[model samples]
Target: MSGMHAATHRRSGDPQPVPPSAGRPNARTTVTRLLCVGAHVDPAFANAVVKECIGEVADTDRFVAPSYGYDVLPVLGHALIARNRRRYRRTAILISPFVPVLLSFLGMTATIIGIALWLWATWAAVFLERLITLHTLVAHLVVPAPEGGRHGFDGRIPDHAALTQIECDRINREQDGSSGLVYYSGYRPFVGAGTWQTSSAFPILLNRANDGILPPMDDRRSPGRAEVAPFTTAEIMGYIQRRLTAVLQAEEWEGQRIEELEIARRWYRTAIGRVRPVSPKDAPLPTEQGVEHYDAAREYLCVRVGSWDQEVVASVFVNLDVRGRTLYTETHRYELRPIKAAYHEVDRLPTAISPSDVRLVAAKAVVQMAGEAIGAAVTICTFPYHLLLRALSRNRPVSPRDQNEFGAEFPARRADVLDYGARRSVREIGQAPGAHHFFQDMDVKKYGDIVQKRVSELVIDFLEERNLDTGEYRARQATILNQGIIQTGSGRIVNTGRLAVGENASA
Candidate 1:
């Protein structure tokens, strides 16, 4: 995780001095999907790991599906440690009985140690209770049963949200002391509603990104939502289109049916409108004024490739791309999620809690007696218990599953785990819906007026690529550069301007 955080911070501007994990720029080499029980390798780092895994996939002809849930190892380790200490109790219990026999040989030392072990056991009982209380409290926090996101409509950012800059800067700072920008806009997309599998093409995305097989960085400083740099919605969609084009282009495909085609409004799914009031505590302050309710549903554009295409999907969610310092430093973040089936495999109980407390106690008692009565021969019993602990964890593989089921029902969980990306999108997708209803049903080919002059070239470049005539394209570009919206579709692209001025998600 530190490696993932440091690698990106080096790319952007981060004040925090996070030590990069071993391998530095070669983070791809050190990728472990789930490094430990609870610690997850951010997709940024896991992408490289996936690339290495993909070669194995081809050889095995099996999909490495990601899995998610509470890791059982941490508490399991705690249990094991607690169990190991019982050996001391076993020593006291077995030796005390032989006091009449051993007093001739060892005297008071043996008696004193026995007394100490007994005292320790009583104290350990209290310690064990404390550990249980701690475990129970932490469980309530992690278990979605009593949380905000159980039904997937919790609206909280997914745990893996740390894969991006906003995640690192915002969340990490939130951890230290400072407060992040407050949002008041109620621009909820799902409305406490469950969404479908989001990105089916995650495996492919990770495979490529890890292999450094990504779209060449042609442009980094894209204009964003701000007062001076008022970027229009079309421009944002254009970037998404461009990124998608690059992803589709890099894929190794056998089809010749559609090699290249202008991505139009039909390829996107979007919803933007006014809703109810959402306080700043819930909604961040809107950058643009006249936007009243934070509860209003905001912009959401799910770019769709050809229907049912099992391809990786990516969201290059940008906060600001200013050339600050160098014009202004912009935060360019990307989240790539693959679709997998294992996300549906819900882990109901904590598997680590399987070790029996009574059994552990009993085993320790037997070991001490056997050791005293039979000397080193007690190794035979201790060896088996060591193997048992290993068996408990080893029996449950942490790596991706071998035989994966694709297109599982979406759980709408915000948790980032194996197959989560796909689960979200799958739940939302079944039959492809009508023509892409972008933020305002804007016609991409119609070439609307550009709103940002600094980004005019970008808009023009975007328009030129789409299927647009020279006359219509030039006229729209001129109008748009001056901050005007052209009547491109049956209805003009209306900027409800309801969005708050900030870039952070709602509280």
Candidate 2:
């Protein structure tokens, strides 16, 4: 999307439309459910958990609740989220294929209607031409010029917002027939005013019959796509760790006790600036599409540097933007807060209490409440549509695919989805004028310069002590600084554009 930038999944330069799954491909997944990624997951631990999801997962101490879903998505840890809502240690539910496919059918229906209208107009025009005799000089009054197109049938365009809202209401609505999913992740998905609503599960599946508004990214052939990076995710993670360790050693932190060193990957949305046409004969103007995401790896290192009598601890965030070939190291300053910490222990049910039995009881309870039957009837009556989708779908995936890949093929899955959603979100929900401000863009840029300057200083200082040939040292310094790139936020990474280190040349 031109408006939303997702810096999550590393891409392979292919503009393929991805089949949507909440679990896989960070670049394409919506982050509305994201509260904050828990800090406890180390890369090794996270990988182990992913492996478990791909294989046989049992109820264990860590995963108290496991559900019958495609992949083991982390929910509130109370329920199994895929098939039916059941209470475990944390209650979760697995959604059936019914809702998402229904949304697709509705989209197709709209398209068919739109096409029918156009065809009718075309035939009507021909009939009108025949009725108007060519023999008369007053033919102009009867037959209008072909340029004046017949207005489309039911001329008013469908509101993208309303359509989106209706679809969203249908898709995530609860088992109780209420309009929203039952899970309590604190954030609820909704169709904001003028926003586009979409089912991400099947990329082009729902979009096949969209009205004129959905300008598909696949059809556009957007430009300036970069080739896949040579380094794999594992390789990149390793390199970043090595660099951080070396940097820490040079800064005289060798004796410090490493309390926590965790590696996590997050993909943030990235706005692909402008997509131009392939040739003059192609699109006349640049196309703005929906959201795209880029991947960034963050390594958190917390160290206890000072000993017994007087203890000092520090944590720094190392953000690696592998695509940009830029590394950002953000150092944080802390002030101590004297507040009591609160802990929550989620109650676990007995192992003998079957999860399926619990789910049945909950449903029975809902039925007793009266409102549940209506929602169930609406869903069950649409049985034929689900059957149709199943029969037609060649790739109806039963589970979320594993995003973990090795070797040369780094980022898995298509970073591209059709730009319709992006265009819709921006038009409807752009930041209001004079809303508020935290840190401005300029503030971030300045901070990046400072970090780059410090990095340059460290490298230069190390080289100076090494007694390497001064000429070679300067040359190496340039290469070291030039490897990757810059950006903003609470942290910024800037390239030391010059080799003159001691002074604030790069800063």
Q: Write down the TM-score of every candidate.
A: 0.22, 0.22
Worst 10 residues of 2 by lDDT: 337-346
Give the per-residue lDDT digits (tens) of candidate 2, residues 1-507: 110112233222212222232223231111111100110112222233322222123211111111111011221110111111111101101122233444556698755664454333333332222222111112111122234432111111112221233332221221111111111111211111111111111001111111233444564533543222233333433454555455544544557532222222211121232331121112122222122323111232222121111111111222322232222223332211111111000011121335564455444444432332334445667868998998867554433343334423333333332211111111111112211223332322333333333444553343234322234334543554343454547587765332345652322
lDDT of 2 at 426: 13
TM-score of candidate 1 against the unseen true structure: 0.22
Residue 246, model 2: lDDT of: 56
lDDT of each: 0.28, 0.25
Error of 1 at 318 (Å): 3.4
The residue-level lDDT of candidate 1 at 160 comes to 30
RMSD of each: 24.1, 29.7
